[model samples]
Target chain A: MHTAGDVRVEDRDDPEIIEPTDAVIRLTATCVCGSDLWPYRGIEPADHTLMGHEYVGVVEEVGSEVRTVKAGDFVVGSFVISDNTCEICRSGYQSGCVHRAFVAGTIGTQAEKARIPYADGTLVATPGQPDEDLIPSLLAASDVLGTGWYGAVAAEAGPGKTVAVVGDGAVGLMAVLAAKQLGAERIIAMSRHPERQKLARYYGATDIIEERGDAGVAKIKELTGGLGAHSVVEAVGTRESTMQAIGATRPGGHMGFVGVNYDVHIPGFELFLAGIHMEGGPAPVRRFLPELIQLIWDRKIDPGKVFDLELPLEQAAEAYKAMDERRAIKALLRP
Target chain B: MHTAGDVRVEDRDDPEIIEPTDAVIRLTATCVCGSDLWPYRGIEPADHTLMGHEYVGVVEEVGSEVRTVKAGDFVVGSFVISDNTCEICRSGYQSGCVHRAFVAGTIGTQAEKARIPYADGTLVATPGQPDEDLIPSLLAASDVLGTGWYGAVAAEAGPGKTVAVVGDGAVGLMAVLAAKQLGAERIIAMSRHPERQKLARYYGATDIIEERGDAGVAKIKELTGGLGAHSVVEAVGTRESTMQAIGATRPGGHMGFVGVNYDVHIPGFELFLAGIHMEGGPAPVRRFLPELIQLIWDRKIDPGKVFDLELPLEQAAEAYKAMDERRAIKALLRP
Candidate 1:
C-alpha cells in the first residue's frame, strides 16, 4: 500500500536466503486480508507498507540449516513467523513468540519472491507439488482457516456444544466449518447477506440469525432454549459484534474472538456477573498447520471456497477494492 | 446502608420462613466485605440497603419442605441463594443460576436473625454445632474464602502451577491458602503490609513481592525465570491491579478475578496479543460450600484466620469503621 486507499504494484529485487533457517519462496498465490483494509482505510497509519500475509508457493531456495523443505517443494506458511523452539511457541501460542515476525510489512507475500524466516516452524510442506485445483484450499490453511480453527478451539466448540458465529466474513464462515468439523451439535451463523447466509449454510450452519446486537443475542438465547450457546466465535471486532458475542454465550461458556480488536472495552461488572471464559489473540496457525494441511490434502474440507474473486498480481488494487466493496469474500491473487 | 458513608443499627421485625425451601438462622457471626466499602465510600449507590452477606449460625427454624438442615442445626450459607436443581447451578455456576438471588438487601445477615432461601441449595450443614473457636473460620467459608477458592479454581491453580495472588486483603490472602490447598508449587503474594505479608506466609505463600504495578509484574517475571506465573488470582479490582495480574500471567496462562470491579476496562489490542485466559465474576460460592465445609470439618484448612477484629452487635457501626479505616483485615460481629 503506497497510501490510504492507494495500491501500487512495482517490480522489486528478488529475496534471497539471508538466514541459516531462511527459505525464499517463488509465490504461486497470495491474497488480500480483512486486516489489510485497516491500513487501506487509513484507520491505521502506514507509509507505503508492504501488505499481504497469506501465501502458497514453491520453494526456490533454502538456507544451509533448512531441513523441512527444499527447492521445488510446495509450501504454505502462517502469517506470523515464529521460532518454534521458544517457550511460548512450545506452549501453543506461537503467534506470541518472543521472536515472532509479521509477514504483512517486513516480508510480504504479494511480491514475486519472498524470504520466509524460521522455515521449519512457519512452512508446511505438501506431500508433493499439489494440483493447481488445490492451490486456493491450501492457501486458506495459511491463515484464515487456521484462525477460524483457533477460534473454535479457544471457544471449546466440540461435541454436544452449540456454537455461534458472530461474523459472516470468510473467517466467520470458516468458523462454522471449523465448529462443524469439531463436532458441534449446533452452529448458528449470524449474517444478513443472502449470499453469505447461503454460503454459511453450505459450510454447515445449522441455524442462521440476521439480527444484530441485543436482538441478535436474544435470538441466540431463544434458539438455545433461553440458555444461549456454549461457545461463540467473535470474528467481528466492532463493539456491537463483541457485545453480542459475549451476550450470546451462556454462563460457563466461552467466547473466542479473532478479529483485529478496535477499542473494545469489556465492562468488568457484566463479565464478572456473567461467569464466562474468554481467550483470544492472533491465531497460532503454526500449531494447526499439520492437521489443516492433512485435511485439505485428503479433500475432507474445502476452505478455499472463500475466495470469490481472482486477479493477477498487477491487479492487486482491484483485488483490495473487491474485498473492500464487499464484492468478494476474499480475493485470490496469482503471480 | 441508609446512604453512602453511613452505617446504622436499626431494629426491625424478625425474619420468618416465607418459602417452602427457606430456613431461619440466628446469626452467631456476620462481617463486612471489601466490596461493601464501594457503597460505604459512595463509589456505589445504596438507599438504606441492608448490607452483610457472610454468615455462619445455628438454624432456628425450617420450612415444611426444608431438608438439608433442620432446626438447631449449625449451617453455613452462601451469599447467593441458588436452587441446586437448576442447570446453571448444577453446572457449578450457582452465582449465575436463573433462580439465583443476592442476599445483600432482602435478607441481610447483619441482623440477629436472617432468613435463608433455597435452604437445601444455599446452606451447607456443618458436622455439628461448632465450638466458639470455629465460628469465625466457618463464617469465612461463606464468601471471602469461597471467592478465593473460586479464583484459584477458575485460574486452574493446581499441582506444578506457579500461582500469583494480586492482593493482600482477606480475599487475596485466602487465595494463597486456596492455591496452596490446590497444590500450587509456588505461591507468590503481592503485599506491602508486614502484618498481611506475615499472614500470607502462614497461609502457604512461598514468596511475597512488595512492589506493585509494572514493577510488581517485573518482579514476578524475574521470580518465575522471566516467564511470569502459570496462574494469577486477581483480588484487587482497580485498573492497575488487573493490569498487573494480566501482566504477571505467562502466555496462555489463566487469570481469575474475583474483585468487585469498579470501572475496570481491559484494553483490546493488548489482550488480543497476550493469549491469556481470563474468567471472573461474582463467585459461585454455593458451589464450593460443601467441599469447603468438609475440609473445615476435617480440620484440613482454617480459612477463618482472616478475621482480625471482633465486636458485639452494638458495635456494628464501629466494625464497619474499623474495616473502612483499614484498622482490621476483617471484623467478626457477635450478634
Candidate 2:
C-alpha cells in the first residue's frame, strides 16, 4: 500500500529482509493510530509515508542475529525498538535510543510486509501462533494498546489514584482502559461523543465530564474535592487540551501526555504555580509491548473491541478516513 | 519612605499596629531585590509601593497571639506571614495559603517602623539580638537568601549531584551558595558577567558557560558526558531561560524554578520528552527562614555579600537606579 492523503491500495514492490538483524513479517492485522490523523489533518510532516503503525504479524524471514524467532512465529513489536542495552534504552527510554528506528511508514506495516529493525529487542513472540479471533487484539498490543499503557504508567496511574483522561480518541480511551487495569480507583474520562462515553464507561471510567476549559476544571474540582485528579493523561496535543489536563490535576499530581505535540504552548506561570510533575513523549511502546502482549495472549482483557471498523489492506485510505472522520473508533486493516 | 521610578527617602507617620495579630518592628537594615527592580523597569505594576521586603529588625511590640517573640527580640520573618496551621499552609506551601499576605508594600521593611502580620507563625527569633555587624547577613536571609535556599531544596540539590543554575542574578548566585552548602559536587553557574562570575566562583561554581539556547545545551552536554546535570535551578522566567533550565537537566533530573514568570510560555512537547521533575513558584521563603536564619547566626555562610552598594534610606531612588541600571548587584537602605 502507498500512503496518499490517506493510504492507497496501490500495488508496491514486495519487501525483502535486507540486513542480518532484520525480520520480514506478513502483517496479519494492522491499524491506524490517532497520531496518523495528524498528517491527515495537515499538521504532521507527511511525504509518501505509509499510514499505519500498529501491527501483529507472522514472521516470514529472520536475520541471522535474530536467534529468538523462526519463519512462522507470531509476534508483536513496539513502534520504535532498540538494543535495550544502549545508554538511553538501558535507562528505560528506548524511544530516544541512539539507533532508534520507527516501524510504520518506513517499513509500511499496513501492507503485506514489514521490515522490523532490531528484531531481538523490539519484537516479542507470542506463546503460540494465535487464532484469527485473536488477531485484532494482538494488533492492538503492537501500538495503540501499548502506547496507552505507557501513557498510564508515565502518568503514574496506580492503586487508589484518580486519573482524568483528556481526549476521547482511541489512545485516550485505551489510556482509560490502561489506567483501569493499573488499579486506579477513579477514572474520569473527558469526552463529548455518546459512543465514546459508552466505551469510556466500559473501560472503567467512574465519571464522565462533558465540559471543557474553565467550566470543565470547575466540574472536576467539584467531583474531586476541589483538589483535582491525582493523575491526568493528555492524549490530545493542543493549547486547550494541554491546559485542561493541567487544570484537572491537583498540586503534586502527574500528567502523562502521549499526544504528538504540535505547537502546543503551556503558560509558564500556571505550570510553575500548579506544581505537577510532567513526563511523556512518543511512548516507549517497546518497553511495554512484552507485558501488554502477554496480557492480550492470556485473554485477560479485550482491547480489540476498540476496533469498530475493519477494512482489507487494499482500502488503507478508507481506514484513515474512517478514523479521521470519526466514523470509527479505530480501523483495522487486514493484509 | 517613598517608592517611585527610584526608591526615595521621605518622612511618614509611624505605622500603628493594624490588627491585634500584628507587631511593629524597628528595621536595622533592608536591601534591594531583583524582584523589586521589576516594577521600576515598567514591567510590573507601580503604585508608590512601600519598596522593601528583606529586613533584619528588632521587634518593638508583639500581638497578643505572638508567643514566639517578645518586644526586644531580634528576628527574621518571611516576606508573607502566614498562619502555619491552615490546611494549605500546613501542606508546606504557605506562600499559597488562603490568607497569604506580602509585606513589601503594605508593611515596608525599607522603613524605620515595619508592621508584621501573623507574627507568631512568621517571625523567628535569633539566638539573641544580633550585633550590628551581622545585621546585613541576617537581613539577606529574610528574602533573596532564603529564597535561594528554598530553590536549592526544591531542586533537590544534595550530595553527589551536579546542579545547573540558569540565571546569574542575586538569587542565582545565592542558589549556587545554597547548592554548595547542600553538598552538590558540581555546580554549573550559567553566567558571563564578570561580577557574577567572581561571586559564582567564590560560592562554589565548578563551571560556567556563557552560551545561550542550543549552544548552551551543547556546552552542558559536553560538560556531563552528554547526560546533562542532575539538578537545574531556573531563576529567570523567560521562555529561553525556562527552556535552558529544562534542557540542561538529565532524564530523571529536577528543575526548580524560582523566577517570577511573567507572560512566559513553555512548549509541552519539549517538557514531556525531557522527563524532568519541576517545582517552584513564589518561594515559600517562610519555610526556609528559620533554618536559613540559624545558618546566618552560626556564621557558617555569608550570603549577604551579594549586596554591592549601600545608601541611606533618603537616597532610595539612587539605590533603585543603581540596581535598575545594573550598577549594583544589590543595594542596602538603612532607615
> Best by DockQ, which number?
1
DockQ, per-model, please? 0.78, 0.45
The alpha-carbon deviation from the true structure for residue B67 of candidate 1, after best TM-score superposition, in angstroms, is 2.2
Q: For candidate 1, write residues B1-335 as lDDT tens digits.
A: 88987888899999998999999999989998999888898888989999899999999999999888999999999999888887788888898878788998878888899998889989998988787778888999999999999999989999999999999999999999999999999999999999999999999999999999999999999998887888999998988898899999988889999998878887877778777898888899988998998888888999888999999877888888898999999998889
> Each model's fnat?
0.80, 0.48
* Model 1 score (lDDT): 0.91
lDDT of 2 by residue, A1-335 (tens): 22236456666787777878888888888888887887777776677776567778889999888888779999988877666667667767777665677765677677788888878877889999887878888888787787788789878999989899999888888899999999999999999999999999998899999999989888898998777887899888888888998888776578888877777888888887776667777777778877887888788877898999998877777888888779998999888
Best candidate, lDDT-wise?
A: 1
What's the TM-score of each model vs. the native? 0.98, 0.89
Interface RMSD of candidate 2, in Å, is: 2.5
Best by TM-score: 1
